[model samples]
Structures are given as structure tokens and as C-alpha cells.
Target: MTATIHSLPRKAEPSLEPLMTLVADGLNSVNTVILDRMQSRIPLIPALAGHLIAGGGKRLRPMLTLASAALLEYGGNRHHKLAATVEFIHTATLLHDDVVDGSDMRRGKKAANIIFGNPATVLVGDFLFTRAFELMVEDGSLKVLRILSNASSVISEGEVDQLTAQRQIETSEERYLSIINAKTAALFAAACRIAAVVAERPEADEMALDAYGRNLGIAFQLADDAIDYDSDAAEMGKDRGDDFREGKMTLPVILAYARGDAEERKFWEAAIIGHRTSDADLDHAIALIGRHDAVEATRERARHYAARAVDAIAHFPKSDAKAAMIEAAQFAVARRY
Candidate 1:
């Protein structure tokens, strides 16, 4: 069934800009670490990494690490290093994802793979992955290392899972959740959980923050999937309907397929499953999704996850940082791009 924003429950959201501003100093430190580590004698390594890293991406994952640390009143430099590590992991994933997805644009600019050869992009991604581990080892905490390392493994597994599920019309919601959890949410969970670890906070607090990040990550991905069909390339960093073109079985596609009539199901099977879609077919797909309110339904689902993310932080003492974290959860679902 179709749903509207007014017809479904939603959580209050504040803009992410304020959250970034609140942690501006910490984010600056993270950026410095990112710049320093991207350097290499090979020249191309730093150039390729910097192209995307300096690209106007939001840096949300590292900000989570910084904000979580601040929320706990942790006053140490380790979180800065760890935040940079989280960003490296995220940036590495983006590099690999562009190659895997064969995307031509990133952050409204030509993709690194489009400029530098795919081999270089892939190798630079490897370089950043190794750099992340170096930072982790430098932190000298087995617990932190274990958490990020496992998250990295899960992220790779998630990518493999997504590869397996491509153009799969019958991909179930449960399977989709597993893929997103591993590819996207796992790092977020690790980033926030390690914040509590660095602060020497109790286990309960760490788990709570982990839950928050995981749910927020899920919400963020859901919104991104929905936006792919609705937003302009300039706003979304890629062409509209890229998911449909790629035959990706995102939540909106899955929902529209499941809710379609027999003839409509055939259309989806042809376009998404059979890979016979064209630009006109994408337009029809968008119309079908709108008729079924699939995009709105996905956004509503994102709201549910965002609410859970906000609720997970209830135990933390009220502070500006804590409030900003809560708002960040809301922002995940509410953001247009």
C-alpha cells in the first residue's frame, strides 16, 4: 500500500550543518589526519585520494566518531585519530564502490575511476585501507583494532552480498537489510562504539551508541535509495534513476515489485530482473513507484529507523553534543541528498 509523509509517523529532524558546526574543531583535526595520511611518493596515490576526500562530501561517518566522543565528555586526541580512521575506511569503500558499480560521477564531479584508470583507483583504495589499519595500530588498542577490523571485513562481505543480489527482483527485505547492515551500518556501529571505548565508558553506553549509529546508517541508506529515483544529479551527486539503470533492488524497487499487479510485475521483471530497461523505462518505473508511493514508503521506513537511532541515545546525559547527535539521527532520514 502507498503511504505519504503525513500518513506515516516521522521523527523531528534538525539540519546536519549545525551538528557539523558543533564538532567543527574535531572535524578539522580529522581532516588534517586524512590529508597527512593520503600523501605518498607515488604522487598519484595522494592525488586520487584527495580528489574524492576533498570533494564536497559530508564526512558523516567520521563526524559520528567525533560527536560520540564529545557526548561522553571524552577529552583526548585518540578520537581524532580514530575519526580519521573511520573516514579512511569510508573513503576506501566509496572508491571501490564506484569501480564495482561502474559509476561515472562522484560528489557532482567526474569519478576518480573516470579520470585515473580503474587500476589506480582500486590500488589507491587499498592504500587507504592499509592507512586505516596503520592508524588503528598506532592507537595501540586491541579492542579498537578488533572492532574496526571486523567492521572492515563485514563491509567487504556486504559488497559481495550486494553484488550477488544485483538485478534480483525477488530480493527479500530481510536480505536487503543484511546487505545494508554489513556494507553501510557496520562501520557506523564500530565508529560510535569505539568512541565509548576510547572514553573508557561502560559497556552499556558503548552498545547504546552502537545501536544509534547502526540505525542511523540504515536510515541514511534508505533515503539515498529513494533519492536515486527522485533527485537531480546536481543535488544527489549522480544521475537520477541510477539505481534503476543499474538494476539495483533497493527498497523502493522491492516494494513496487511486490505490490505490482501481474502485468506490472512483468514490467519490473523485464526492466530490473531482465535488464531490458532504458531511459524511458526508468521514467515509467518512477511513475509506477510514485503510483504505489514506494519512494515515500521507503522514506517512512527510514523515519522508523531514525526514531530508533534517536531513542538509543536516551541514556546519555543531556548536552549540546548529545542533542546534536540526536538531530543527526533525524537528519539521516530527512535529508534530500
Candidate 2:
């Protein structure tokens, strides 16, 4: 599909810049802890982990952990190690995800599979995953482990479900939500919940932080799906139309197919479901998405989630960390560049 697109996410209630300042500094400290914790008997493990670790991502999960801990007034820097643990877990997932999806790029660079081979990349991902569990054990809390383990399970399940569900055309929003919650929001929920655990906060605060992460993650993934059609390869750091090529079921294509006129619907059936797609069919799909405003509609929904994520943090008393956490939620929605 070929069409122009535009989105101007509504302004955040509070500017995220000041909060990002604190988060930016904390990440360095977190990385240090992650590195120190990783010094172990298996030297190959670290070398393999290093290959993917060096690839830059947004670091959203670790940011949530540190910010949430700071909000609850954690005195020491324990959150730093935990934050790195969170990042390591997240990176491990990405490595496995790329392998599973046969992906070519991440953060606008060659995927580990391209550089290190799929087997090595897969093993490194395994190393990071185990290391994440090992690092979190230092917290000496089963609650934290439970959250992370559950997230890991859910993420795995989600990946499997998505593999089966993609390009099926019969996929529903209800099913999509289930898949994304498991695949995307599970980790996000864990990240925020772990911070609350670190603070020894009340259950209500923990639940709210969990909700914040869940909502933020959903919004982030939805926005990502919305952008896939026209995203610049350079900007997205990956191939455009990847979800389409892979026959993935994402919000834009689903809503567009549901709402499209007869001819447009046929395009989805022939190109997407039947895999009979030609350039003409592709362009038609793109046009129908724009005509029905599917992408914009998804963006609107994503913004609503971001708003809810910000509101969830209101339970904590205002602090630099809290503000940063809130801004991170806002950043999840509007951070296109």
C-alpha cells in the first residue's frame, strides 16, 4: 500500500524532559551494576551477551524499575543492579524474538543472527536470560522472581500464539490483546512491579505501578504496529512492512480489514490471507488503511493508554523519580524519532 501518513500525539500534561534527565543518568549506573554482576565463570557467556548488549534500544524497562524505586524512596542503589537485570532480560527476549521471527535488523543495525549466526545468537540470548534470573536472585525475594518468571512464560506463550495467529485474517482484537499483553505488557508489568517490591510499598502502589507498565507497553506496541506500513527503514532500524511480509496480525491491518469497503477487503483476502499479493494489491491495502484512518485510530488509542499510564503514577507522592516514571509513560507514546 502506498499512502502518506501523519500523527501528532497530544502533548503530555507534564514535560518529560526534566524527568528524562534523571533517568538518563541512572541508566549508566545500572549498566555498571549489570556488567559487574555478569563477571562469572563462563567467559563465552559474557562475550556472546556483549554482542547483543552493545546494540542500543530504548531501555524502557530498566528506566521503569529505577524510576519507580526512586519514587518510593529507596535509599540505596540496589535498583541499579535490578535495572540492569531488567535490561538483560529484555535484551535476551529481543535476541530470541529476532531468531524466532527471522528478523534482519534491530535498532537500525544488523541483527545478531546476521553477524553471529542464528545458533550463536540464540545461545547468547539463552545466556542473558539465565543471567537475568541469577542477578535478580540477589534481591532475595521470591515475589520479584515470580513476576519475572511469569513474564518470561507469558512472553513465550505470546510469541507462540502470534506465530500461529499471523495472517490468519480471522484474528480478533480480543485475541490480539491477549497476545500483546503476554508478549509485550508482561515484562512491562514486571518491571514496574519489581520496583514497588524494592520499595516494600503497599499492595495498592504495586498494583498501580503494574497497571502503569501494562498500559504503557500496550500503547508502545500498538504504536509500533501502526508505524510499520510507512516507517522509514533508517528510522525504524528495521525493514518496513515486516509485519505484513511475515503475515503478522497487528491493529492497523486488522482494523483496516474490518472496516474496509468490498474491494479493499478483497485486497486483504487475496494479498494477506492468500499470499497472492502484488504491488497493486500492496498499494491498495495501504490506500484502504489511510482511507479508513486505521493507523490514526490506533495512534489515538495508544495516546489514551499513555494518558492512563501517567495517571497511574499519581498514587505516589510527586518526586523526581515519579516524574521520570510518568514521563517515560508519555515517552512511550510520542517517541517516534
Best by lDDT: 1
lDDT of 2 at 65: 83
lDDT of 1 by residue, 254-315 (tens): 99988889998999999977566787898899999999999999988888888778778877
State the weakest 10-residue window (summed lDDT) of model 1.
1-10
Clash total of candidate 2: 4
lDDT string for model 2 (247-302, tens) is 78788888998998787777787666647556565566677888889888888778
lDDT of each model, Cα atoms only? 0.89, 0.78
Q: Give the winner by TM-score.
A: 1
The TM-scores of all predictions, comma-separated, are 0.96, 0.90
In angstroms, how far off is 300's CA in candidate 2?
Answer: 1.0
